[model samples]
Target: MNFIESELLRIFVGEQEKLHHRPLYELLVSEALERGMAGATVFRGLLSFGLRHKVHTSKIFELAGELPMVIEIVDITEKIEEFLPVVEALLRDSGAQSLVTREAVRQWTT
Candidate 1:
């Protein structure tokens, strides 16, 4: 069995101002990858709400507006640790929070 030791970094940030969620997430992932991080991805919640009383969830068919987005990146301990500072700076600049970072013991890949 193959194994990977890494940290799973999950960052939840608000969708506000001119900073679009998808683009921001892509940028973050790209930046991390460029720094030699394993990989990163962004996940958009269909119906979700977050800080600043921003409500992206709605029953109507029409799209409301900005929604909470999560950027997940997994990499080795050294790499993830190196990325933490950068991630923090980005989050601070964007005024976003709810960052959850933890060490992952195993990775199951086919």
Candidate 2:
């Protein structure tokens, strides 16, 4: 049950956000892998809101596909720091709204 110490970076964005007609989450994961990140994951939220305080969900009555999505990457502290600016630039260029958080992680691999 031993775990390795690492750093976790989480990015919150809307599912409908895209760049060059590509989903932002897919772009993020590709970028992370290309940069040799240890791992990256994307999660879709059933219901959520952001800075605008607008709610988005996957309910049958909803009119849009803009659900909340989160992309998470984990690696060493130095690597995460180095990648932060790159992520920021991507967000800026894409005109996407996102929230990023850094935290300590205990990871285990088989």
Candidate 3:
């Protein structure tokens, strides 16, 4: 097995938020792909709150669009660092109240 030190980039946004009239998650994933990222994955969160501390929850049985969405991408630290400003710019351009974070990780290949 081969392993490398990596960085995990995580973006948090509301499901209803949009950029360029497109879903933010979709835009983020497309941007990552266009930047030649290792990969991007989006996860819908059940309950979440940030900044203003307003809670958002959407039960599976009910229809709701305010729930949180998380976009994750993992790659080498340099790639992730290079992508940070682009993510920030996108968020700013969208005027989205969002969160972006990064952490160290290990990626293994067999």
Candidate 4:
């Protein structure tokens, strides 16, 4: 067994946000893949809100059909740090705002 200290980047976004008419989530994962990162995961939330305090939910009516999306990527510190700016650029290009968090953790490897 082996383990190493890695960085985890968690991005909070909306399902409807798009970049060039494509889903933002798709682009996020694709970028991570292209970067040769260790791994990435996307989680769709049934209910969530951001700094704007606007609530989005799966109730269909509560959020007006919008749900929260979270993209999490884990990799080496250098990789994560390098990718951080890319994420910001995507958000800017899409004209959307999101919350991104990065932290350190132990990553297990085979």
Query: Model 4: which ten-residue window has the lowest total lDDT?
Result: 57-66
User: Each model's TM-score?
Assistant: 0.74, 0.89, 0.91, 0.91
Q: Clash totals for all models, in order? A: 0, 0, 0, 0
Query: Who is ahead in TM-score, 2 or 3?
Result: 3
In candidate 4, which residue pairs clash?
Answer: none
Query: Which candidate leads in lDDT?
Result: 4
lDDT of 3 by residue, 1-110 (tens): 99999999999988889988999888988989999998899999988777777777776445368888899999999999899888998899989878888899889999
| Residue-level lDDT for 28 in candidate 3 | 89
Encode model 1's per-residue lDDT on 1-110: one tens digit a residue. Answer: 67787788887654442244545566677778889877788877667754555556645445444665678888878888888888777666666555566658556566
Model 1 per-residue lDDT at 36: 86
lDDT for model 4, please.
0.89
lDDT of 2 by residue, 1-110 (tens): 66778999999988888999999888988999999999999999888777777888788456357787889999988889989988998898789988889999978865
User: In candidate 1, which residue ranges exceed 4 Å CA deviation?
Assistant: 17-22, 51-55, 58-63, 103-105
Task: Name the 10 consecutive residues with the lowest summed lDDT in model 3.
Answer: 55-64
Which stretches of candidate 2 lie above 4 Å from their native place? 60-63
lDDT of 4 by residue, 1-110 (tens): 79999999999888889998899989999999999999999999987776777877787675754787899999999999899889989999998778889899889989
Instruction: Provide the lowest-lDDT 10-residue window in model 2.
Output: 57-66
